[model samples]
Target: MKLLKLVPDHTNIDFVRLRGWAFGLTLLLSVLAVGVTFARGLNLGVDFVGGLMIEERFASPPDLTRVREVVDAQGLGEAQLQTFGDPRVLTIRLPTQDGADEGATNAAVKKVSAALTQAFPGATFTRYSTVSGKVSNELIRNGVLAVVLAILGIGLFAIFRFEWQFGVSTIVAIVHDLLMTLGFFALTQFDFDLNIVAAVLTIIGYSINDKIVIDDRIRENMRRYRKMDMREIINLSVNETLPRTVMTSVTILLALFALLFLGGHVLRGFTAAMILGIVVGTYSSIYVSSSLLISLGLRAEPGEKKPARVDLSNAERIAPRER
Candidate 1:
């Protein structure tokens, strides 16, 4: 099915003005989100802080408040309990006690395990574990490397397919999306973990595809509208591609919404990040990437002659000679 219909030929739309407003809004939101992140730190997940993760499955959905109280009662450092997978599944995260020996960590886990079993009888428990400090450091390093490599790869691809300017603008838009996603995590204090890193990478790949589509249209316009002004051509290109952008974004959002609401906790963080990225990525494609291209001196068409202004003074100056 055709998801988008082309605007009739000879239609006029003010792309520059539309892009300007979109860019302004993105800039405002990005700045505000950054400020919020800095003011209130992100809630780093177990992957960042050294800790233990426990997963338990009950015959029925366990009571979250009761589980939290039981775990807290054990004094096994600070623990967080939430449902995962099915409603019957529960995951607990707890910080390792300060200067605690191996025995202490084990003891804490055992105490919490015992308490959970008592609080919810006949529940089956499984302990899946990791060291928080190590996980956190590893995740941070890997995430940084992944983003850097993605940018570099995109830059090279852009340079190869189009121009350095295209590569640069594409990378900027990708970073824009990444930072915006991070800002969301920080603002909400959502658990930033390995899965989230995966989500960010997924977003980066997706956002770049959108950027490339718009960039391709701009390049095509350069060849087709040989006499148009740069601003006018860009506006035209954006308008031509606007329908596809909206359609793709909407379809992706629909899928993400389903995952966000129904995929359970195992997929919640991933879905949440994807949903946020979809919105930001769509805006960045039109506003951030395109505007950055204009800002970077993208020319409309090469060798197009400028029409000289009708100079009445020059005509007057030569009138006596002509007479």
Candidate 2:
């Protein structure tokens, strides 16, 4: 189960104070990023923009300039050319006009195919898909709904599992991770699409798990160390769990890096998003979530009644005599 065997033991840094500084900076940066995303908007892929997607196979790899010339000869709005699975497979993306008729669209496709055939004899092309604007709109709406639902689900789960403070802190961390990821996409202008949505959702789940793990430890420490200060207890919990957090992140990063480099163009965007998410998720779990807990005035001392037990089965247990 231990993927990393050389992780350093607990450090005695003042995590609560460090958490505050980190969260404040992250919040300010996030607000600015969100503003930019709202103003500039995401660079949505062909999936969200009704377009003609053609996959062509050539005896020899097609020339990019020639492909562009052929598609432009068809008078399509604009054509994007990229290699797909291999050098021989070319992907052509063409955006349909705002009010073009089906006849116009088909004619454009025919013109491009004819020109490409004339230029590169023996090359074969296939119509991968032609999505409509209406479908793309529906997809955009559904993707937003899914993200909202995921956040709500996480909040509800946190409430049931721990307390309102834990729920609030965890939700804030999730939102932070999401906004930062979106900011990265907007700033870099990545081909944000359905696959990116899947990546974001995966990040949400992964980030929340990290927060929950830390919160679980904090809750346990709160019960055990009744006399400790809130800051001390939070710090203790974070320090104790830091090794596991780091190891998990490293393992996820390695897998994502492999996908980024070796998985080809189809998985490039997906893996890039995942890589960014893992880094942001880990950072927010440690700094943003923990800091938010303190900001919400969560105290280590139990209020009125004892809190519910948080399972510590995986954590190292110290015997009474050892303690």
RMSD of each: 9.5, 5.6
- Model 2, stretches more than 4 Å misplaced? 1-6, 55-67, 76-91, 96-114, 117-127, 302-323
The number of residue pairs in model 1 that clash at the backbone is: 6
Model 2 over residues 51-145: C-alpha lDDT tens digits?
A: 87777777898789978887787767688887634688777888865455777667766777777888898878666566688889999899999
TM-score (C-alpha, index-matched) for candidate 1: 0.78
lDDT value for model 2 = 0.79
- In Å, residue 277's CA in model 2 sits off its true spot by 0.4
Residue-wise C-alpha lDDT for candidate 1, range 1-323, written one tens digit per residue: 85455443333456566766777777777787788788887776677776877778887888788888888887766677766446888888888665546776777767777787888887776665656576568878887898799888988999899977898888878877877888888876667778898898899888988888878877876786566666766666666666667778888899889888888666787898999898888878877787777778777655666444322222212222210
TM-score for candidate 2, residues paired by index: 0.80
Candidate 2, residue 178: lDDT: 90
The alpha-carbon lDDT assigned to residue 76 of candidate 1 equals 66
